[model samples]
Target: MAFNFFKKKDKDTSKKQDRYKELTVKEVIKATKDAIVIEFEKPDWEFTYTAGQFITLITDIEGESVRRAYSLCTSPLVDEYPAVSVKRVENGKMSNFLNDNTKAGDTFKVLEPMGKFTTEVDAEKKRHLIMFAGGSGITPMMGISKSILHAENDSIISLIYANRNLESVIFKKELDDLQDKFEGRMHIIHVLDDAPLNWQGESGLLNEEMLKKIFDRIPSWGHENTQYLMCGPEGMMKNVEQMLESLSIPKDNVYKESFVQGTIDKAQKETTEGSGQDYEVTVLFDDEEHVFTVPADKSILETALDKDIDLPFSCQSGLCTACRGKLLSGTMHLDEDEGLSDSEREEGYVLTCVGHPTSPGVKIQIG
Candidate 1:
């Protein structure tokens, strides 16, 4: 037997995850009636971020500790306070609090930035970047589009943004500024679900025909120079994928990231594909241990939440490593792994947001 001693950098325990630091709110801008942009002063700690990474905000709300992740709408390439846009979600605890209660001069702790929905941009490469953003999914795309436009001189960005109507569009004014700043280099196409009279832009949901028309704008797709970045509803993302398959485009050309609904299943919410039997696991996080009875179909994070365990988590879709832990001893299955690197798996690290223990007595160290 051969042992691979080449340790992965990402799995190295020495690299401590950045702790949450107090960030002073500089200002708050109401992007729309339902969405607001909060800007924060950068802390003293060394913080550097890519285009699409997210910041995890921890707040003490109504006698309960709540944490939620929001993508940075500010670009790292641009010197500004780290900013994130919050759109009001129906019955969303954190979203409502952020939208209705948060204000300038307030202080909150934000975890270090982490996310994998990013790409490397080369200034010399002349490529066409196409992005699809729906609702709040436009957050990260804003940073990415700005970064690409500012850093990558030769690359062009085409953004197809979807909204319920003109009033519901997030970052409407900022996007318009980008259009003016980039002129011919950046092109934006607004796709509204509810359009006003004499509406000329696209109005229907994303389908094969709509996707074909969107791709038709670019002279060369399914080739080496075009890269697709999609973030939005799962149905729309899949529609684009299906269209790509039909066009025989290489899978590598398209990149996508989606938001998962919640860290755990809520009351009466049924999930699919599990043994339906209760499985036991012990989780250790931040020097505290808690035992949870996780249904085979539910993820460990979900189980923790149901049991009222406060676990540090962001982006329940496994795209953020906040819920990652070491699998000390367990037989678990991981369904989504884009956030984790290949080397991290070899080092026994698993994203608990998407990990399920198959049997009882699984031990996980989440600290």
Candidate 2:
């Protein structure tokens, strides 16, 4: 299953008049050797987003419509312009395209921000936020960190960031400046895989021993006042989770965000136990109902897109819940349901990106 990113939150989008907007690129700042931060000019209408939400960028690449979601690294509470940091991934079409060709004055269609990797901010609350980030996973954490530090004066943040090397770390200078400005409230520990000759900080794999040493250097708040957040590569996150479990931290206190989809089980997608035949599915969205026949081999979102039914979606690998909808009737089988919470699953919520109709009279309501 894909790593579940955040807790599900209720959001109604069907009533909104404008679902997508054309945002002009205001500036592009080179954040690292292989990463660039794209800042967009605020639209005339209200475009508010929480700290950890992601925006879907739509553009035509090689004559085909390509859409990719990038988390907003800028904090709505502190930053002047809304921006997203894009780190180039090897063989990643969208990331490479944006870094190589995107410039100021260019315009692209962007979907409104949507995500659940966020928490409510309370100025009076004094708590601790422990974050573990690696590689590009630091994007969402950057916004969350900035928002917490600016909004909650008494809340403290302890970030354990891991990277390939010193030069590969994103937001190095920005993090240092925040640490300096926040002083005691914000602390950062950097761990590098390949350290320089005279490196003073921790260097090597973030194993159990390394984590113990790092934890000793940071302040520890009791379970009642502490929360944990993590975003990073799959292996790194798995290690972190194991370490946290060994420490006897409650599972309820930990949350994570994942952009990469997990390995898919082909057998699960081949057929559902009950319904192996094609069936008609109904999708209600934007005050319109679409009725279409779905092939057994195609996913709901894929079939809908092939029929020119413009549906809201990003991260089609089932990691992002952008195509989430309520299953009004009938049964559906999901190739992956990691994006959903236990409560959401019990409430009949489904992700169209990985859903397949397993029974007739299927109706889904999308917001």
Candidate 3:
């Protein structure tokens, strides 16, 4: 019933102009102590997202609004209803609301799934995947790892998970079950920052020495053809990247997803006093157009959002391509060129999250 209503409304609005969808909770499962898996019945939901893409979950609070993006933990083609596993953070407004207030049959708006952190499994190429996960950052990696293991039986996956203690590990039972199901194809090693007083497993951070020890047990440590995925705290990723560099691993073979949030307001404030120049932005939406003035320091996304035009976005950190759009005209300066491919940028596609107009007039197709 909820799916039908949302689908009707979405189609009607989308036919008239641009519109977004709100997925309603069909069921909720207590996955772990801090994690809740909320399943939404999107029968009409077009599951077009890539495996590791994330959706921004939005809810209304006192007529104000709150939202936080969570990566989907299930594969796109899974028969299960569309769902995402959320971890509640202490003192976090959205997390607390999701953990405590959200229940089965509740409805909430969700932005379209977007993110560049995805896996492309090549069947012909013998692929070996290495993933490093920490805390809740394991969400996307879980999706990719599970999909690869299930879809391509020949693919090898090695996952290194770090948590404070055994109790803190999410999907502990499920992963263990999968290991038993698929013997040698999948490997998972859990590292604890502080072990239980009686714990006997690996007791230490996922540092160079620990990784080396684990790699010795499994020889595919620095395979040239392997793809490396690093997702976790900024410091952890940096440390891992440094370690990989020391091993002479190719940089392009390595992919990273930072579970870091950007301070958009702080970025805006820092650029406020720049006396920066102005640029004209031509926004093309629904066969109509609007002209907006953007400060040289402000990104095109910020300019559009400030004008109440809902442009797509997730991590405004220029990592996710949620705000990606084709440039119908003109050029722009990008802060971090992480998500944009060379061809995409050459063809004039830009990530508006961190893109500032470099020229006087820039025309773009806005969602």
Candidate 4:
């Protein structure tokens, strides 16, 4: 009788403990002209993400809500105050809200950090870390650069940050101060895309000639030991990638992010406009299924939400892949997606934000 009573007590305790797991909540922390930073706090949530992971931020609109994702700029070391910076984009619903409304102490919803951009710094190897970032996309690279400088004092880091002008550069003062502190250990070159001719730094755009000129001062670090992280506008990144390839840089050592949300939005609009057809989607969760007819004017995600079906999602632009679902049946067309890789798409996963059903029985499993 005593043994049975003890076993029952243990089971009850375990059940109660499971119920006490902390839930995720959004908290507004800071607001600035170019950006706003939100901090998330959950007791049970412990993010073991590396230096370059990104997270999605979801906001509830008055009638219809939209989501956006930002690369986390703050270090993972801060257990109590993990945060990310989001720059406001012109005509963007979420970015405008983040810029105009969010305040410190206000709450917001965010998904867990997810990304593969990372570094493997070893004391045995004399690795040189080179980072290139443009405008607000500097968030993740900032975290990585700071982490490298903080961890290994001897490691060399050369960063070239491009912006419209001096006032628009994020973390400008901080980077300048860091340069003063680190001296030769870290180097920063600011490139202005649009500036007065009096601009004392490099101008126009980053290209092979500028990259070669900058690196000419430093020794020729072999491609095997050097790592490059590039984050910026799609055009800038693509140009830099081509230049690096022409320079015989290793493909595996280069990293880039699909942060171009505006392009994805344009592609989505174009696809829907050109399709000229409407279809229905059947979503299955648990044992129950829900069906809804979608219009060509709206995305599948929007249609599902309009029908009052709660679906898990972040970054409605299809950049975060938070709304990825398996295509159990039926054919679908996608606009533009940078979230899922080739493998995920080959396995029949689709980003619902920009996806539309082409067949009648477009079924997807949901939770």
RMSD of each: 6.6, 6.0, 6.1, 8.1
Instruction: Order the candidate numbers by lDDT, best to worst.
Output: 2, 1, 3, 4
Best candidate per lDDT, number? 2
TM-score of 3: 0.84
Per-residue CA lDDT of model 1 for 1-367, tens digit only, reads 1111222333332223445567789899999999999998877787788989888988988999788889999888874778999998889899999999889899887777887788886778788888888899999999898889988888888898888898999988888999999998889999998899999988988777898998787656337888888888777777878988898877778788777543345332333334576777888765556676777678888878776666678777777788999988867877677667767889999988888887667889987
Candidate 2 Cα errors over 4 Å, as ranges: 1-17, 271-275
- Over 196-260, each residue of candidate 2 has an lDDT whose tens digit, in order, gives 99999999998778888888887878988999999989888888899899999998899888888
lDDT of 4 by residue, 1-367 (tens): 0010122222233432332222243676443457666665643556556677777666677676566767877665523556677888888788887777776445555556777666754454467888888887788876787777777756888888888877778877768877898888788889887877688888877776777776676555788868888888887787778877888888778877767764546765676656777777777643445677878777788887776655667667777676788999998877766667777889898878888887778888754
> Which pairs clash in model 3?
none
lDDT of 2: 0.88
The lDDT of each candidate is 0.80, 0.88, 0.75, 0.71
* Displacement of the residue 19 alpha carbon in candidate 1, Å: 2.1
Error of 4 at 16 (Å): 19
Show where candidate 1 strays beyond 4 Å. Answer: 1-18, 262-311, 317-319, 326-329, 334-349, 360-367
Q: How much lDDT does candidate 4 score? A: 0.71
Looking at model 2, report the run of 10 residues with the lowest lDDT sum.
1-10
Model 2 residue 136 CA deviation (Å) reads 0.9
